[model samples]
Target: MSSVQPYVPNKDFIYRAADALADSHLQQALAKAGRGFVDKRSAAVTRVPNFEAMRDRARAVRQKALQDLDIYLLHFEKKVTEAGGQVHWAETPAQMREIVLQLCARHSATRVTKGKSMVGEEVYLNEALEKAGITPFETDLGEYILQLAKEPPSHIVAPALHKTRAQIQDLFLHHHALGERDLSAVEAIVDEARQVIRDRFLRADIGITGANLLIAETGTVAIATNEGNGDLTATLPRAHIVTTTIDRVVPTWEDASAILRVLARSATGQQTTTYTSFFTGARGDTDKDGPEAFHVVLLDNRRSQLLGSEYQEMLHCIRCGACMNHCPVYQAVGGHTYDSVYPGPMGAVLTPLLRHRDGDYQLPNASTFCGRCESVCPVKIPLPDLMRKLRNREQQEARFKGAGYWITKVFCALAASPRLYRALTSIGTKLAAALGARRGRFSKLPLLGGWTAHRDFPAPQGGSFQSQWRRNGKAQPPVGACPAGD
Candidate 1:
């Protein structure tokens, strides 16, 4: 899908999604997808006894590589140049766009076909190409659907998850020249897309793709996918342009193998992706069919600023989409609510850093802080901690930080004082008990209507354990104070 850069406030997105979620169909879809993803990933991970150990190794590999990123990047540049390819460093999206535009101009190309690459989405390449009088085509089925509908992707892996099959049939009937043919089944849809994208692949002048991993030691781009669209995009056109973030570098192919083992299991419950293609350079003179010109654009849009920081772990993400698959917020709201190229738990952290750092402040507050994302992450990225850090950064420094800041600060400070905490707890419990509904749930709350907009909040219990202990004349609880399971 192309880039969508309009700002979205967090409150508005939450409310909108909360409303959409009330629909039984959407809720059913979310529940079905969530259980399927969780179960499949669990089964896939169970098959591998040493997956946790591999995660540890993968984490260390990325950490060490990030320490000397510049060295590895220069090494990559040299190797790529030696192999009859070019490497361009783009410090910003605009610079990347300019470079690709210039490449198109040099080639005198009007049509460009793309593999589904998030980096290409990051730079809004299709829109930029269109503005430059070039027609850009998305070859991935989900991406093509979003392209035809003129909508941002709703999920990272399944961009068209929000669209029903009937909606797709209508879309195809309206767009495809097949002119109202029977398109009711999934296989039929697949066949239709394959037929349409074949022509675009053959006639396109330049192809663009994203790399899953960039091997710094060999200057190879590793494109992983269930479909071989990436390979088609990289090799079929006259010129192939790879758009990748600077942080994708790991040190070696060995490291790539380790990460790959975890990526597919986490992403789609497959043992390995159907196609894992590694390209060292342009198709050589001895090679038969590959792009004549190859360009690898290393994009550093705010990634350089992320080095030696708390958020550096985000760089280790392989874009596996595991976090999104397991995320509660993403399962409900999908990608569009975040209103960024990157979406879900990872997007909550990365989007604000990548685009609209000041005014576009809604990206960070889009989570429930459930640690499932971290648990399912193949590289063991501390997503929840990173999210809290982003929220803290916004509260402390971002110009668009919201009100109620002092109130939150006051509560935190009160919690630090035992006497004040006890006093507040007593008062809060009594008030909650007095004002709560018969079922002990509050339908609405002052200054917290957002929380009660869609569902009721359970009221606090009438007494704290500390207060009960005090009343019972016991400073210490019994040995079996722990719950039954404990």
Candidate 2:
């Protein structure tokens, strides 16, 4: 395997993954996963008559919560304290890491067992712990695989989905100290993970997890998982910590229930997760297995700036992975191409927002604006619209607002003129088709060398749709009128 690091915003990694993803193997895997997820989601939607209405209601709840975030966050903190838990606020990733490390120090933690929390990933918690000499063990299977591989998450929901069973088997055989045995099946592989990690749960000094939703009214945190890993990570140690973005807060337990109704179904086609546990505080009266101390770290990390902005709707994401599941681009390239902890449609929107790009540019233009993501989002987030806003952000940045930007603006202005647009389109299509006709595809592109390096370019069609429409007496019809026959 290549020693390539997680595809951060580094220009080189982005281009490399874009090139590597062109291989047929990656394409086949992405296509299979994408189509399967969409079909399953469609079937699930059909099963619920009020699915659309439920999404609308979920949207309303999240909107109301975000609109009044300050009020609800304070309410959440008060109740959590009342329930025998302490709340900590982090304004940035550095502060978040510092607080967690101090908490670990307070417990004299030598080893920390962790559940899969993307917020923790966002803060690079494992690295922080390692720097402080605390060994952080990933309890979630997917996370465990990634930790063994020393790789960041490729996809948000399915962290190890990109790795096939064979790869996993190979990883286990090479990494696990157990003597040789059959590793042909998924069950065997899971057994290996469990055998290795089960002891870590009991031996660790602290347990940490990510919260799905934080209920302000009850001061309760919800953890949803298919595996029992989250439970182990939350209960097996003396101290338990939940790291989450401030956006996770819901006004009340009733509102959280409403969101949960859509979260699992949209995520994995389950009406409810196999394990949806609500923890109010640490181990209490008659609670023998839970931790003695509970702490919730609410990370701001640029989110407060996003509150009143056009991209605020993105805060509603429940990490369901629906948008990525249905995205055509993500299907073709997998999550690696996006070059971040977040990937796919939601990543396309959130990565640029968090990373702070400088230019008349953001990377989400990589899409065709199909709007399928928006249609399927359980919380009704307008993903494409937000993606466009990110693009505008690039334009607003001074670094990218120069000559290249003016040229692009001029081209868009020209393209708006129908006569010139059709002429340019006709000429470009003719040239492209002619260039590719000999071999059925263009092996290289003039301006998009990175795009063409690994895959052949699809030739343009002979005629534009608008041209065909105009030739058939469909030109200049009334704004809302039907075709000539109608």
Candidate 3:
């Protein structure tokens, strides 16, 4: 049982969420990144004709890929082998780490530079590299900042979205001795980071990046980055390794193209990334510069088990960060509150599936069910639906804590018998209607005071729905669903 971010141990999700809500610095950081991501994606999508159609195409591509995942993956592996690259399959993070470490050791790698990869985060590759005594450098500006600060990423696309400009300035000033260089302007800060990591790309023996999309038709892996670091990281090193999950494999370059069209627009609101580089395999005799050895390590990590299951739709995510930007809960509490490699709506459904620790189920409860995450998702993953499913499953499994345990047990018991349920609700509603008609709403309740403290709970105007339905005689249920039995 390895943690998602080993450097930072897990904490109680509810407590962390409360802390996140209270922290002013975190509030400032969330306010800065949340609005910008939403606005940029909104503006970018508007500029494209049939953006919704593009999303539909991308969603179809993913669904088709996963539907025939085995065919595409085998085809991808064969293509890689033909192109003078090796493909290694890992069923777990440990196996993936071992595969990568063996690759690094074989290459005699002492220095490694990494592109920003959530797959890398999922496997905790940085921690593995450090434990193996290899010096790993993060080339993405946001990743580099978090690396220097020894913190896990808050957002997937923008890792340091939780850090303010002032905070980054302090990190650089403490870590580097840049003399009299004004690092106040945003451009200056970017320049400073560029200067700092310029040589790591050249000196590194191994470069590892995550695949944004993998093409089975051409045996090519594509990476998209705002910074050109991914290009340098992949090309400059003696060996290149792609650390990605098996779900990234698409059937063809056309399918890959379909996804790429939406990836950048949803991520940074750019039509395309500044550098969307594709690599097939090792450099040939005629090629001047590229990695001598190329490897694509596909980590399963329980993802293959999800195929044909209800949760398989999660595999469609493109890591655009659009869901997080639009998510009210994520905007308020930030990614760190989820305490997983992933955060926000995606993580709420994913973290528990990947790592079901004590508090993992709590993530599904973090949502407001506003459906914003689903609305903004480029792949159209039913995130709210998935989260609701997880929440229901958790309660059914009785995986709750303390007072919540008994409370949920009581509620579930009450809900099991239709007769008891209708009878209890009939009496309760009548009681509330009669008592609270004067005030119209309850300011406090025994168990729901926290909710009532902020807003009044409306008193029921009459008997329960079942009672009213029977009284009406010709009444119908909403949406034409069959009426419940009593």
Q: Candidate 2, residues 267-334: lDDT per residue as tens digits? A: 88888889999998878898767888999999987888889988899999989999888887777677
lDDT of 2 at 299: 93
For each candidate, the alpha-carbon lDDT, in order, equals: 0.82, 0.84, 0.90
Across 92-204, the per-residue lDDT of candidate 3 in tens digits comes to 99999999999999999989999989989998899999999999999999999999888999999988888899888878877888766778999999988888899898799
At residue 297, give the lDDT of candidate 1.
94
**Residue 372, candidate 1: how far off, in angstroms?**
0.4
TM-score of 1: 0.91
> Per-prediction TM-score, please?
0.91, 0.86, 0.90
How would the candidate models be sorted by TM-score, starting from the highest?
A: 1, 3, 2
lDDT, candidate 1, 150-174, per-residue tens: 8777677777776777667777877
Better of 1 and 3 by TM-score: 1
In model 2, the worst 10-residue window by lDDT is: 1-10
* TM-score of structure candidate 3: 0.90
- Candidate that beats the other on TM-score, 1 or 2, i.e. the better one: 1
Assess the local accuracy of residue 1 in candidate 3 as a C-alpha lDDT between 0 and 100. Answer: 20
